[model samples]
Target: MQLCEKYVMQLLGMSFLQYSKTPMNDRWRDKDVTVFTMHDLVHDLARAILADPVNNKGSVVGNGCLYAFLTDCSKPLQLSATSSANIKALHFLDSGKLELRGDAFSLGTCLRVLDLSECLIRKLPESVGQLKLLRFIRAPRIRDQMIPNCITELSELNYLNLRGSHNLSALPESIGGMKGLMHLDLSGCHGIRELPK
Candidate 1:
């Protein structure tokens, strides 16, 4: 392990001894680091890593990683990846309505910022509460979607946006549970007639 660590440090400018020690465990915990590839990542490993709430660095992957996933069209959200770990911030394409359906509660944990604008989504997972560090959530086009009552668990959240969710007629009675909320946007929620106090 020591030799491998020295070699890895020489090749990547960092020590990998911590990773090498955990032979059975695929996850290597650290903070403030940036991941830039998915060549060695496996799907199960990614799931295990994301399921942990103790770490806080983001995984960065290349194009090949993008092709490795299969979509699940049944659930409200599905996330498949060889590398989507320790992400603090995420930017989605095709209108940010992530095609997360095959796997329920795939958003994982420890996220600080989430943006899913104009994605035409209809709902979010109750598992979103897994993101204990989440402070911002922005998904404007998901209409009539039932917010998980668990969302009230995100005591760290400061911002929430439901703008343009024209069909979101109701919100969790727990809306009043977000004690850290500083700004909320429901600008285009035409169907909403009441907010939880």
Candidate 2:
């Protein structure tokens, strides 16, 4: 396990919350980190590594490691400018509303995990399919009626979640073609009347 010692401790803690499933091997990162309280850590986020809240409008915070949040996506937010290429995960905070530019999905080149379960965006950007290395996706409750067909191209993706997605009505026609898909969650998706044939 090449995961840093701190992240290793994090996995142990997440297991206590019934969040981290057992990984296949060292190469597989246990892909679940939910909000949980820990000693010295109030919840999932440990601390802010970088911040300039006073001048920053709405920042994407990452330190070539893990986790970033787009606090304000009232308009089309640009992630490419703030985030580094080495980030593994990105999550949107604030619980208001979000709108991301399609081109902004190019988060450097090495994003592996994404958590959009909180952001109530109008739609899932088509560019999301371009993140070919992504292994985990936790996007739920999107406002769009359909997910982009191109998302089926993510060959490394294993987990896709659309829990409580009230407006997401249809999945990609080629969903079954995702070679690495291991787990899919459709719980609470009220708009989907039938699964793709």
| Candidate 2 positional error at 82, Å | 4.3
lDDT of 1 by residue, 12-129 (tens): 4211122332233235344443343321222333464456544244443322122111233233333444344445544344544444331332453545656555244667755577
Each candidate structure's TM-score, on Cα atoms with residue i matched to residue i, is 0.55, 0.62
Model 2 worst lDDT window (10 residues): 37-46
Number of clashing residue pairs in every model? 5, 0
Per-residue lDDT for 76-99 in model 2, tens only? 334334545666566555655556
Clashing pairs in 1: 35-60, 77-100, 77-101, 78-100, 78-101
- How high is the lDDT of residue 56 in model 2? 52
Q: Pick the candidate with the highest TM-score.
A: 2
**In model 1, which range of ten residues has the least summed lDDT?**
13-22
Off by over 4 Å in 2: 1-66, 74-83
Error of 2 at 184 (Å): 0.9
